[model samples]
Target: MPRIELRTEIKAIKEVVFDLSRSIDLHKISTEHTNETAIAGTTSGLIGMNESVTWRAKHFGIYQNLTSKITEFDRPNYFSDEMVSGAFSEFKHEHHFEDSNDGTLMIDLFDYKSPLGVLGKLADKIFLEKYMTDLLTERNRIVKEYAESDKWKQVLTK
Candidate 1:
């Protein structure tokens, strides 16, 4: 398993950032490059504890489907989503938020185990880890963008 942790500072309240993080609509916007779309279950709006969403996206030149469910949630503070079925052997993503002088400190802890055993380890060392990191970083950038401005209303108001 590989763990990737990231911290991002945003000039927005934790509540706003939290909502944006779980917003299904915001997720689609952040992953437009991958043509990621919520194909079933909690397809739009904020995803709450126990809710699952199936996403269809193009990755590595192939289309894939992954379903993940919100396993834990604490409003404006922490939450976690674990993969129900996906390409990876298993994966869990934890989101944490804390108030800061500037606004909010957002943290992401992503842990995943790729399939194929040894080959998966090699993939992580070579590029998969970085690829996943980049994807999460971009998503956070978009979250910050929305939270720091009035744009957040567009996603949360619905």
Candidate 2:
């Protein structure tokens, strides 16, 4: 498995950041480049513990569907989602948030294993890791943007 860890500092309340992190709407917006959409299961709002979402998206020029469930969640603190079915053999993402002197500290721990065994490992070493890291970075950037501004209201207030 490959793991990617990221930390983002946002000037916002932990509650707001936590909610924004779980908002499906915000996820769609952040991944617009990949045309990501939640086709079923909590498609539009915050996804909580035991909730699942099936997402369809274009990745590497191909459209793929992935279903993942929130296995663990603690409001305003942390949450972890794991893949139920997807292209990858394994996928687990943990989102953690903490109150900081300036604002909130958001941390992401992404772990994944690709299919095809050896070939997958090679791909991960060659490019998959960087690609996934970039994707997470962009997602966190969007989260930071929303958390720091009133834009979060658009997705969180409803």
Candidate 3:
């Protein structure tokens, strides 16, 4: 398994940032380059604990569908989602938020294991880790952008 951790500082309230982090609409926008879409389960709006989402997207030039369920959630503080079924043999992502003097501190812990045993390990070492890191970075950038501006209302407001 490979674990990637990232810390992001956002100038916004923890609650708002937390909500944005779990918003399906925001995720779709952030992953537009990959043409990712929520095809089932909590397709729009904030995803709460125990909710599962199935996403279809093109990755590595191949279309894939991944279903993940939120296994743990503690409003505004932290949440963790684990893969139910997907290309990878295992996957878990934890999102943590804390109040900072300036705003909020968002942390991501992504752990995954690819299929195909040894070949998967090679892939992780060769490029998969970097690719996944980039994807998470892009997602965080979008979250920061939305949390810092009124644009957040577009996805967060009901």
Each model's total of backbone clashes: 0, 0, 0
Put down candidate 1 lDDT per residue, 26-135, tens digits, no spaces.
99999999999999999999999999999999999999999999999999899999999989999999999999999999999999999999999999999999999999
lDDT by residue for model 2 (1-158), tens: 89999999999999999999999999999999999999989899899999999999999999999999999999989999999999999999999999999999999999999999999999999999999999999999999998898999999889
Candidate 3: Cα lDDT at 65:
98
Candidate 1: C-alpha lDDT: 0.97
Alpha carbon deviation, residue 138, candidate 3 (Å): 0.4
Model 3 whole-model lDDT (C-alpha atoms): 0.97
RMSD of 2: 0.6
Q: Which stretches of candidate 1 lie over 4 Å from their true place?
A: none
Query: Model 3, range 26-111, lDDT digits (tens) per residue?
Result: 99999999999999999999999999999999999999999999999999999999999999999999999999998999999999
